[model samples]
Target: MRTAGGVAGAVLVLAGGLLWDIPGLEPAGERMLGIFLAAIILWASEAIPLVATSMGILLAEVLLISSDGLFDVADDVGAVPAADYLAALASPVVVLFIGGFMIAAGATKFDVGRVLSSAILRPLGGRPRPTLLGVMAVTATLGMFMSNTATTATMFAIMLPAITALEDARSRTAMALAIPVAASVGGMMTPVGTPPNAIAIGILADQGIRVTFLDWVLLSLPVAVLLILVAWAFLAWRYLDTSSPLALDADARLDTSRPAVTFYAIAGLAILGWLTEPLHGLSSSTVSLAAVVALLALRVMDGEDVKRLDWPVLWLVAGGIALGRGVGDTGLDSWLIGAVPWGGIPAALVLLAVAAISWGVSNFVSSTAAANLLVPMSIGISISVANSTAEVAVVMALACSLGMCLPVSTPPNAIAHATGLVPTRDMVRIGLLVGGLGVLLLSVAAPLLWSWLGLT
Candidate 1:
C-alpha cells in the first residue's frame, strides 16, 4: 500500500509539474522539479530500490533537460551536456568510495578484524567496563576505514561469544548497544567512513572544493573521539558492572599466506597514499585504484571479489551527483534559494536547522539518501547566505550519520537490535542522548574548531 501510494504520488507530481506551469520556475526548472520531487518520494518511501531511483534521476535529466534532450526548449533556456549526467558514475568521489569498498572487502576476506580484535581486547584485562570500552574502541577505529555496517558486523562476530557469556542483562545490552553507537560516531572520522561523508565530499568537489583524506580526518576525528568517549561513559554508568570480569578469547593468529602478505602490503600503501596525497600529488582515487590493481594483479583478490563489492552504493552516490548537477544547470538551486526567505534568518541558525532536518529525516531513511536529498540544497543555501559551504556540507553529512534512534535508522543499529539483547526503549533512550549530543557538538563546537584550524 505504501509503495503504491508513493508511486502514484510521484507520477502525479511529475505530470502536474511538467504539464502545468509553476510561477517563477523556468521550463527546464519545472522539468527538473518533477524529477526531483519524484526522486524524493521514491527514495523516502523506498517505493523502488534506492539505486533505481538514482538511475532514473540520471536518465530523466538526460531526457528532460540536457542539451540533447528529447523535448524542444527555447534558445534562452540553458541545457547541460548529456555526458555531464552520465559522467556522475565515475566522479572522483565515487571513485574514492570504490577504493574504500575494495580495501574493506580485502580486510574482511583476510580476517583483519579478528586479528585486530584479539590483539586489542586481550590487554583490557576482561573487566566488564574495560572490555566494553575496548570493544567500542576497536569498533570505532575499524569504522574510520570500513563502512559502519561492516565494522559493526565484524565487531559483533568477534565479541558475541564473550557478550553472550555475561549473566547480567544490562551488561549484555550495554555491550550490544555500544557497537552501533561507536560505529555510527566513528564513521564521521573520514570521508570514506560513511556514504554521507562521501556524498558531501563529492558534492563539494563538484563545486571545485577539495577535501583531502587527511583534511577530513583533521576536521572530524576529534568530534568522533569525543562522542565515543561520552557514549561509553553513559553506557558504563547505566549498564556495566565493573566488578565483573568478561572472558574474551579471540583468535589472534595472523594469516601468513603469500596472498595475505600481499594484501597487507597493498592495504598499507593505499592508506599511506591517501594520507600523503599532498606530498605525492596523487588523488585519493588514483591511489585506491593502484591498490585495487595491485591486489588483483597479485591474486590477493580476484574478479569474484570485485563482483561482490558494493556497486549499489556507488550508483546511489552517482545519482546524487547527477541530481546536484541538474539542480545547478537548470537554475533549480537558485530557484530553491529564492523560494525561501533565508536572508532574514541568521546563518548560524540556518546551518543548525539544516543539521536538525538532516538528523530527523535520517532517523527514518538511509543516511546516504538523506544526504543525497539535503546536501545539494544545503550547498545552495550556504552559498546564498555567504556562509562556508564546506562547513555546512560537513555538518549536514555528519548529522545524517548521527541518527540512531531506532533499529531502522542505520544498518549497524539494525544489526544490534537483531541480537535481541537490546530492547527498543533502551535503544531510543541512549540513541537520543548520543544523537542529540552529536548534533549539539556539531552545531556549536565543531564550527569554532574548524575555524581555529582554518578548515572552513
Candidate 2:
C-alpha cells in the first residue's frame, strides 16, 4: 500500500510538472519541482533506503537539473552547474556535523557520557517521579550541545539498568519514551544541537539574514525549556504513580583517570568556543574540526572511534542541502512565492500556516528534508509579503525540530521505537499533543519576540 502511494505521488508530481505552469516559473523551475516532489514522496514512504534516495537525488540533479543536462536547457533562467550542486556535499554544515559526531564519539569512548549521566541521575533518589524528571533533565541538557541522537543513546544506555530495575512496566516504558522526546526538544535550544537548526540558519544566511549562535539560543531556549517541562508532565501523568519504587544500580562508577579528564577539558573548550562564536569570529565548523583533531591527537579517540562517527546522517543531510541549492538555482523559491497568495493574510497566520505545513510533512519525512523544502519557501514568502524573514525562519526551524510523531520521523525517535517500550499509537498520540502545543507556542511567541529583538 505504501509503495503504491509512493508511485501515485510520483505520478502526481510528473503530471503537475507537465500541466501546472505558473506565470513566473520557467521550464527549469517546473522540472526541479517534479524532482523535488518525487524525492519527498520516496523519502516519506520508504520505498527505498533513505540514504539510497539521497543518492538518487544527486543522480537526478546531475543528469536532469544541471546546466549541461543532456535532456534540457534553461528557458528563462541560468541553469545550475554541476559544481554548484556537488559542493553541498562538503558544505560547512556537513563539517559541523562531522565535528559534532567526533565529539560525541570521544565522549562515548572515554566514558565522559557515562560519567556525566551517572553524576546527574544518581542523585535523583529512588522514587519514580523524581527519577524520571532527573533523567529528562540530564538528557535534555546534553542535547542542547550534542546531537540529540547521541545524547538519547548515551543517556538511555546509562539509564536502562535503572529503568529495568523499576517495579512497574508502565513507569519503565514512560521513562524510556521521555528520553527521545526530551532529546528532540532539547536540540532546539542551540543551532549546532541539530541538523534542522543548522539547515535553517544556512538557508537564511544565503538571503542576507545572519543568525548567530547566541541569536538562535535567545530566540529558541525559552521555547525548548517550556516544552521539556510539558513533556515531563505528560510522561509523568501517563506513566507514574507517587508510590512506585525506583532502585538504581548504585555501583556505577565515574571515570576520573587522566585521559577522561583531558577529554572533558577538550570537550568543554569546544562547547565554550561554540557558545562564543561571535566573539571568536570563527565558524562553528572550524571549532568542531579543532576538537576532532584534539581528540585524535590526545588519543582520547582512536581511528576506530572515527569509524563510529555518524556518516549515514551526514550523507542524508548532504542530500537535503543539495536539494535546497537546486531549488534556489532553478529560481523555484521565487516561483513558489509568486504562486502563493500572501497579500491580505496576517503575518501571524502566515507563520501558523507555514508551521502547520512543515509539521505535517515532517511527521512523514526526514525533518532535515522538511526544513530543506520549507525554510526556503518561508523565506520567499516573507520577502513577497514584506514580512520579517527572521520571524519566518524561526518558525521554520522550530516546526522542523518539533516533529517526532512516527518511528520513521527521526533517528532518535527510531532508536526509541526500536526499544519496544514505545508503541506507534502511543507515540502518535503524545507526539500530536506535544507537536500541537509546540506550534502554538511558536506562533504566539515569535512575533512578539522578534519585534522586541528589533528584527521585524
Candidate 3:
C-alpha cells in the first residue's frame, strides 16, 4: 500500500511540474505546488521514510525549481542555488533539535526522569486528586525540556503500579489519560519541548522574525499552563473520584554517580543559557550545540547516545524549511497573498482557521509532520491577511500539540492507548473536549494576550 502511494505521489509531482501550468501562476509556482502536493502525500501517508521524503523534496527543488531548472526563466537570477536549498540540512533549527535530543538522551541514560517524578509527586501526598495532579505536573514539566513521547513513557512506568493498585477503575483510567495529555500540553511551554514550536520559530526566522527562547516562553508558557490546568480539571471531574485517596508509592533512588552529576550540571547550565538568551545574545542553536559538546567532553554521553538522537525528525524539519524557501523563491507566497481572499477576513479568524486545520490534521498524522505542513502555509496566509506571523506561528504550534484524539494522533496518545486502560471512545470524547478548550483558549488568548506581550 505504501509503495503504491509513493509511486502515485511521485508521478503526480513529476507530471504536474512537467505538464500542468495554472493560469496567472508562474512556472516556478506551479511546479512548487506540485512538489508541495507530493510532499503532503508522502508525509501524510508515510509512504516512504520521512527522511527519504525530505531528501526527495530537496532533490525535487533542485531539479524542478532551483537555478537553471525546468521552471527557470529569464529574470530569475534570484533563484535559490541548489547549495543554498540543501543548506537547510544543517540549519540552526536542525541543530536546535540535535541539542535537545542530546539532553533528553542524557536524562534518560541517568534515570533523571524517575528521580524527577518521585521528587515532584512526593509533595502531593497519596490522595487521589493530588496524586493525579502531581503526576500530570511532573510529566508536563519533563515534557517542557524533553520529548513528550519520552516523558509520557517514563511517567507511565512510574505511575502504572500506583494506578493498578487503585481502589477504583475510574481513578486508574483518569491517571492513565492524564499522562499523555499532560505530556503533550507540557511540550507547549518551550521551543525545544516540541517539534512544532521549533518548526514555527525556524520558519519565522526566514521572514526576519527573531523569536528568542525567552520570547517563545513568554508568548506560549501562559497558554501551556492554562491548558495543563484545564486538562487536569477535566480529567479529575470526568474520570476520577476526587474524594478517594490513592496509595501510590513515591519512592525513587536518585543516581549520584559522577556521570549523572555531570549530566545534571551541564543540563542545568544549558537551560539557564536558554532562559537568558537575551542576556548573553548567543543564539539558541549555538547554546544547544554547546551543551551537546559539554555532554561529550564531560563524558556524560558517548557515541551510543549520539547515535540515538532523532535524526529523522531533524530531516523532516529541514525539508519543511526547504519547502518554505521554495515557496518564496517561486513567488508563490507573493502570488498567494494576491490570490487568497483576505481583503475582508478578520485576522483572528485567519488564526482560528489555521488552528482548526492543524488540530484536524494532527489527529491523523504526527504532530511534527502536521507542523511541517501547516507552519509554512500559515506564514503565507498571514502574509495574505496582514496578520502577525508570530501570532499565527504560535497558534499553529500550540494547536499541533493538541493532537490527543486518537492512538495515532501523537506518540504519547499511542502510549496511553497501548496500556489498554483508555478506550478509543473515551479518548475521543475527552480529547474533543480538551481540543475544543484549546481552540477556545487560542481564540481568546492569542489575539488579546499576545498583543499585550508585543507579539502582534
Candidate 4:
C-alpha cells in the first residue's frame, strides 16, 4: 500500500507540473502545484516518513522554483534564492518548538512529571470524581509545555495503577478517555504546544502578521480551559461515581539532586520568559534559544538529550512553512483563491467552513499535514474577504487540534486506545461530543470573544 501511494504521488507530481495546463498560472506556480499535490499524497498516506516529505519539499523548492534551479525557467516566474528554502529548517517557529522540546526532554530525564503529578493530585484527595478532574487538569497543564502524545503517555503511566484498581468498567473507560481529550485541548493553548499551532504561526509570520506567544495563550487558553471542563463534567457524570473512594499514590518524591535543581530553574525561567514576553521585550524564539543554551551549558541536558528531541515534528513544521511561502510566492494562492467564489460568501461562513474542513480532515490525516495544506488557503481567503488573518489562522490551528474521534486522529488518542481500556465505541461517542463542542466554540464563541476584546 505504501509503495502504491508513493508511485501515485510521483505520477501526480509529474502530471501537475508537466501536463496540467492551468490557465493564468505561472511556470513557478505549476511546479509549486506539483510539489503541493505530491506533498498531500505523501503526507496523507504516510508513504514516507513525515520528515522525509518535509525534506523533499525543501529540495523540490530549491531545485524547481528557486533561482538556483537546475533547469531553465521563464524570467516571469521570479524564483527566490535557495537560502529562502533552507532557512525553513531554522525558522523562528521551529526554534520555539526546539526550546519546548529541550524542556520536555529535561523534565522527562529528571522525572519532573511524576513529581508534579503526585504533588498536584495529593491536594485533590482520592475521591473518584475530583481525582479524575485533577488528573485531567495536570495532563492538560503538561500538554501545554510538552507534546500531547508525551503528556498523555506520562500521565497514563502514573495513573494506570489507580485506573486498573477501579471496580467499575465505566469508570476505567472514563479515566482512559479523559487524558487524551484534555491533552488534545491543552495543546491548543500555546504556540509550541503542537505542530499545527507552530505551522499556523510560521505561515502567518511569513505574511508579516506577528502572533506573539502571549497573544496565542490569550486567545486559546480560555477555549482550552472550557473544553477541559466540559469533557470532565461529561465524564464525571456519565462514568464516575462521586462517592467512591479511589486510592492513588501521590507520594512520589521530587528529585533534589544538583542536576535536577538546575533543570528546574532553567525550565521554570524559560516558561516565565515565554509568558512575560511583553515585559521582557524578547521574542519567544529568542527565549527558546536561551533555554536551549542554558540546558546544555549547565549540563542539565547533553547532546544525547538533544538527539532525543522530536526532530521529525520540527521538520514537518518547517515543510509547512516552506509550502506556505511557495504558495504565496508563486501565486498559487491567488489561483486557488480565484478558483472559489469566496467574495460572495459571508466572512463568518467562510471562517466556519474553513474551521469545519480543518476539523474534519484532521480526523482522517495528520493534523500537521492538514494544517500545512489548509493554512495558506485560509490566509488567502481571509485576505480576500478583508477578515483578520490571525483569527483565521488561530481557528484553523485549534480546529486541527480538536480532532480526536478515532485512534488515528491524534497520537495521544492512539496511545490511549492502545491501553486496551477504552473501547472503540466509547471513544467515538465521547470524541464526537468533545470535538463538536470545540468546533462550535471556535466557530461561534471564540470569534465573539476576539471581537469583544478588539483582538481582530
TM-scores for the candidates: 0.98, 0.90, 0.96, 0.97
| Backbone clashes in model 1 | 0
Candidate 4 per-residue lDDT over residues 370-391, each given as its tens digit: 8988887867888788889889
Model 3 score (lDDT): 0.83
Point out the worst 10-residue segment of candidate 3 by lDDT. Answer: 69-78
Off by over 4 Å in 1: 73-78
Q: Compared to the true structure, candidate 2 yields what TM-score?
A: 0.90
Residue 235's lDDT within candidate 3 is 86
* Candidate 2 lDDT over residue span 1-456, tens digit each: 888888688769856865677667787778778878888788777777777767677777776678867555655463767777777778777887788777777667776666666676678677777777888887887887678888988877877777777777778778888898889988888776887787777676666777777778888887888888888888899877668767765455767887778888988898888889889898877888899888889888788888877777777777777777777777888877777788778877888888888788888777877886677676678877787887887788788988899998887889888887888887887789879988988887766876787754
What is residue 324's positional error in candidate 1, in angstroms?
A: 1.3
* lDDT of candidate 4 at residue 127, scale 0 to 100: 81
Worst 10 residues of 4 by lDDT: 70-79
Better of 2 and 3 by TM-score: 3
Residue lDDT tens for model 3, 31-64: 8878888878887888787778888889988888
